[model samples]
Target chain A: MKQNSLFLDRATIVSPHVNGWDEFLASLNCQDVISFEEDWRAQLESLPMRSRRRLSPQILLAISVAEKIHETLPKETAWVFASSVGEGETLNVILDALGTPEKAIQPLRFQNSVHNAASGQWTIAAGVKCPVTSINAHNYTVGAGFLKASMQIKSENCPVGLVLYDAPLPYPLSASHKINIPLGVGFALKPEPSANTIAELKISYCKTPNPMPFASLPQIPENSYNPILAVFPLLKCLAGSPQEDIFLGLNKDYGLCIKVKQL
Target chain B: MLQHPRTNNCGITHSSIVTCLGYGRSSHLLALREGRSGLSNNHGLDLQFDCYLGKVPDVEGIGFPSRVADFDNRATRLALAALVTDGFEQAVLKIRNRWGADRCGIVLGTSTSGVEMLEKTYKAIPENGAMPEDYSTRHHDNLHAITTFLQEYLGFTGPGYTISTACSSSAKALVDACQLVESGLCDAVLTGGVDSLCMTSLYGFESLELMSKVPCRPCDASRDGLSIGEAAAFMIVERDADGYLKLSGYGESSDGTSMSTPPPDGSGASQAIKAALERANLTPNDIDYVNLHGTATIVNDSTEAKAVETAVYRSVPASSVKGAIGHTLGAAGAAEAVFCQYALEDEVIPGNTGLIDLDPALLPNVSESCRNGQLRHVISNSFGFGGSNCALVLSR
Candidate 1:
């Protein structure tokens, strides 16, 4: 197979229970499936001189995780940010505003309601003017984001950063769909093989119902709403078996085949 | 920096259009030729402001197949309307059988995914004091609605997703689709955009005071603001080198500027144009025409004019079809690209519809009259809020 590979030099994961890859590594050693918890407002206080009310939870958590990945990552590099259900908290506010016809719509919140708000904020905050792809593909969002970044790495022959984040939606919207834990994953990728290369990735995208399902994250439900979970299989391949080809079903028919190799 | 602006084995093998001018390419091209506009008074839109709107009529009258009734929405309806025309659906079927269903992907762009349905639900919420039992925003307002619907509709299981970068969504979708093909993730992709008119945008643009009272006038000296519009446009982009038209290059950039205001001096826009041309490995002189992202706003027209001036040195025939179709926002990228596809095949350069009193500051390249000529290469620009910008180069 002539599939291209990208070096994953640095990475980070943020959830309620886990802080970074080191924590994940610890959890793997202990064989524990920990629950996630975090004080979003406190973590976001790290960023300077920004109002929080205008920003949604997804954008805040996303930027926070991205900031942790690379404090001074080049803004000129391309970015791919993906989510399954974005800004559900603000959606509830919007619906409340709609309920009160007299209540004025918060112009700032309304403008940032679009799916790409996080990407825009990342660019504006970093003051880097470059290409950005904001995606939302239901449960397939994380996989879609990775596929896009992998393609971009091959096309641009440059390093690309991927941020996949989503927060639990407040009910009654949550009644039908529930994502118990809010999670985010950040990855720094490059085209050329390097010392930081974590794996020789042979990634493929297609689905004729590949019966092989990669083992799911221990604590995470099989049908979790967290799009970030899509990358778990890759992480599993990294933390456990790093020399086998594993297939993960992104959806009913769409799947990702990643051959992971340890550094 | 980029070698040959992205080598590609794909081109626009088939396409379809559904806008205020009605369905199909002929209807759209005729308006482009005659400068006939689809923009009319925004009376029924329930807005107090005086604004012109280009809205596709009979959206409610259009019917989806019963099997896919659950996916019915204004945006999907518009997409199906186009998918059924120009043999687009037939082409998709033929390709699926040849390449296998899992070998194709569906990527769509939209600013208001199903927000219109949300607007309807919210309108009823105040009266009912609770969400309607049937109020399901999953199919109507979810960001993945169109992508999921198309995947289910086509029965294809390839990589599918939706991109929403305001007006630049669909243009970026094409870029994403091209990558999918280049990465061997998929063999063929249905790439385009669909955004149905809703109060969210109608009042949203009005709130920003970006909507014009009269019809939009692109590049016009007195151009004040934009005339908002809605449409659905798609092109069956495949990894086939046989098509006459070729998608040579694409460039993407961000202004990192304010959400509403574009970067002054055209630096952000120029970057994208330069990137596309750089990848195409051609100088500005090689471009035969430019499809401007001319939304008729005083700032957009002047800024884009300055950008075109800096990007293309020669006086290539340049125009903005937004004056005819109104600014189709998310779909405008693919819409303008489709217009360019027909322009290349017909060898006719469409005049800037609403560009009457061309800005004197703009070099004399901006044309107001349509002309017949041999066309080789053309580029379409789509820039949007959040400082998202994109440019596409297609050649014949």
Candidate 2:
């Protein structure tokens, strides 16, 4: 399984206004990429749902990116979806029903309660027949899902579509979790590499008494523009300024380091 | 043939294999073996009916971690108790060291992630959507709270993920773990499921008119509905050279028919079971026993029974442990699989405790009391919402 893996290519995220990958990266550094009024107004018209509050901006961003990346859909790629807070809107519906006896559980909301609802929705949207998988690993969700997708590609020798997205929770749930981060979504198209490739990823495990310090790992620069927020750093490193490796330090001081070298 | 590095990839391996050194739920077992119903009438449930429940007794001071705890939730406490038991601590440490905290991963399956906590938060939310400081962080929507707590406690780092596919969650977690190992992703994996009694789940089932007022009797002719209970069970899965119970085969299928309903003819479930048997390269007769996904719900039991009978091992002796544990939801599959391993080791088939007589309509291998015998292989079925089904084969 030492084949050189390629990211192939990805699509440009489309938003209601003009907020794209560059704008998103700029916003991370406290720059207003687009006016709030313009974005909100545009979102109001384009979204399927009526209410402004129901749609989290991050979810919109994620959906936009997903639509783009999946535009030239792979006929035979596996789908892996990762989420931290799953279907925040559905939670609100269930809670609202609990508050009202006459309301009764909405059949649609009930169906959306399963954790895999996002993947299901994506499958329908993408019209892909590949095996779809949804996974939640709390904060480490994206990493875990990525690991699974990577393994699938290696074992099955097929490309994989990895989508990670999380929406801000409904007020009470959102406020309680103390997760104030704006909505975010990331998608990666990973395929096994060919011979004589420049970059490679090797996942290894070592037992050590002290846990690895994850905070010390190099962070993606604040200025890099990428549709996928999570993998922006790796993308930047891959775009020419090659790093030998990027390490995701895990518990027990264990590290899953992705080693890369330019040929 | 292409010779890959064989990087000890995709499976578990270690100097000291983490194992389930002991099981302390025999007291619950003792009560079941004697036919004493763990189900009781409870008014605390928010549902309209005065239903029966298999509530853990005398758990007054069972405090969930305040950060993630909702006073009424029982799932977290149960998982903590299971993980803190005598051998569990050592096993956690051993796995942590063997795979390295960063390289170790935890995968859990659950139908409800602290829904009891969510219920409390729902009751207290202000009309304006304001919430108490800790309301959002409660364990309910933090799907990985348990895994996060476990990761921090045990210092495992590989990959932590949770799978929620209704009843088949834990079994699906096992499937995911095996894939992870087979793909050379992680060295060791901890896979299991947990669920607790909550108004949302209990009442949801009750509203569907699926809760049985009396004890649940799986594969019984007169069986009515399910008796919801709470439990958390985990197993350490590693690439082993001489593992006791090898996860020989697994197969998963999806029936897009409906979420809360079972597939009409059990065709989906049958496919999964047959696939597992075929993957293991063993005929149905090779399986000594079967742990059914017998939720006791009318459709579930009947459909599952038919599927098992149609499976390659049609005549193989089978029983649903739910009769004893009262349907532990997500934990049902993992818990029963562990029980199956024990049954294989002890050579005793625990009786279908609550089933007085086998249902004539449904054909399955049913029995009473523990039968002394050598069980070599077992197939466990777990079917969940949205027609998600998984079958796993564990061999001694």
Candidate 3:
């Protein structure tokens, strides 16, 4: 296995407990756990009212976080946007329309129903035109996103913007999506360190004979089915210790383990 | 695409495709050679529009092996149906024995996953505000459904993820699989996509006025819109292939212009094409044929045509397979790339299906017939919603 190092130049976390990365780090405590609501929306006072009116909570969260680090990124930045269940509410709306005889659907609703809706919104808002991959891997969305973002930086020698976010699915669809808290996290990952770099991480694909258990990690929420929340432990380690190991539980048999050292 | 040299080549060691044209690579190649359009009168949908579609045959009859019955869904069944054919399953088993399970991985892409199941769940919601007992949001409509099912069915787990950037999902998944292999994460990776047709995509496109009332005529002056199709295309990308097409290079670009409409300048698609060419370390001259994204839409065809005309080698023989397979949405990337593989093998460039009157705006390279010739490298383009675009360069 090869060890690839990525310097986390800047990151922003959006959850119920904290509004930005600085707040998150300042408020970081092992015992203090916070839960984000399924459709949490606060006054995104930084953005214009016109822009705020059109975006979903998850997209808004992504933009808010990306805005914090987008300036540090290159003009043509590659992005890997990952979410477990994307725009489930929008899908329900479209599904309801298709279920009827008339099948009258809205154009805007169909546009937002795609899994990459947030990626579209965030890119337009940020005005960065490189490339983006909107993806998901069950509860492994965070680790998968990091793996994808890190690989893009390593292989292509480019700075990558990684965003992991998810909101609640609507109705009977919500039955299987056990996520109680909707959360999002964005990072500007680079191959080399910048002045604003916060941490350096070495990622390796390790053979896990017995996959790591989520129950061992207390920072992870009980009802947190959103894969973005898996990054919470990594953030906690970055905030507390110099050297730490965290397994991003991507699937039952495999995951990405990162060794994070704060710069 | 970008023209740069790569360290090691990723090969299309094994692959399978199941569409309305038929199952297996030979079936598709036969249909392509015969110039058969899979576009047929739309059935199995509740839409009122008179558009054509490429429907997978016997999708309902596609069932799981009794061992993997619990992971059954329309998408998974479609994937397994293709996997069981083309010796893909046997190949995977052999690769597993050679590399061990931990060194083999799978990544599948889907735009709608189990949205059909979501529609069913929408119907079965009780008055008491309870979901149907059979409905599973996690296992059904979630993006992980296809990948999870494949991992469980195969019982081979390494690093896996699902990409869902509309049409470019599977192409990007192949790039991701190549990286996994390059990073020493896995020796063999199942990289492709499976997106089934559903009311959401059908009616959704109809709402956007993107659905054509007839079979799609890509690169044609008579073209109005696209006949959306359903498919499951999978390929195992590994090293040391004997007689397989190589995944030499790939490029991805986000238009950053519109959600649905591509940039009129065609620079976004050009970026991907340029990046892929650069990575392949080949000029436009090196690319013998290109399987265009040709969704038969007015704006997409014009923009992509212009992009290839200027940025890529305009003289490169290009044709859209959408006329035969219809626009497979998320599966289009892998579907078209596999079509390029078969095209290289057969030395026949697929004709622009449904094309009668060629578009005046298009270059002469868009073929009207399945011409036979010596072919080598081919470029496959897949542009999608959210402005995400990916281009892959394949070599024989």
- How high is the CA lDDT of each candidate model? 0.77, 0.61, 0.81
Q: By lDDT, rank the candidates, best first.
A: 3, 1, 2
Model 2 interface CAPRI class: acceptable
* lDDT for model 2: 0.61
Q: What are the per-residue Cα lDDT tens digits for candidate 3 across B18-55?
A: 99998998899888888889889846575688889999
Model 2's DockQ score? 0.26
lDDT of 3 at A45: 45
Which candidate leads in DockQ?
A: 3
Worst 10 contiguous positions by lDDT, candidate 2 chain B: B13-22
Instruction: Kindly list the per-residue Cα lDDT of model 3 for residues A15-108, writing each as its tens digit.
Output: 7777777888888753333554445674464458987876666667666667767778888678888888878667767767765778899998
> Going through the candidates in order, what is the number of backbone clashes in each?
7, 29, 15
Off by over 4 Å in 3: A29-39, A42-48, A209-213, A219-225, A241-243, B1-7
> For model 1, how does the per-residue alpha-carbon lDDT over B344-387 read when each residue is reduced to its tens digit?
99988988876778888765677776788788989899998778
TM-score ranking from best candidate downward? 3, 1, 2
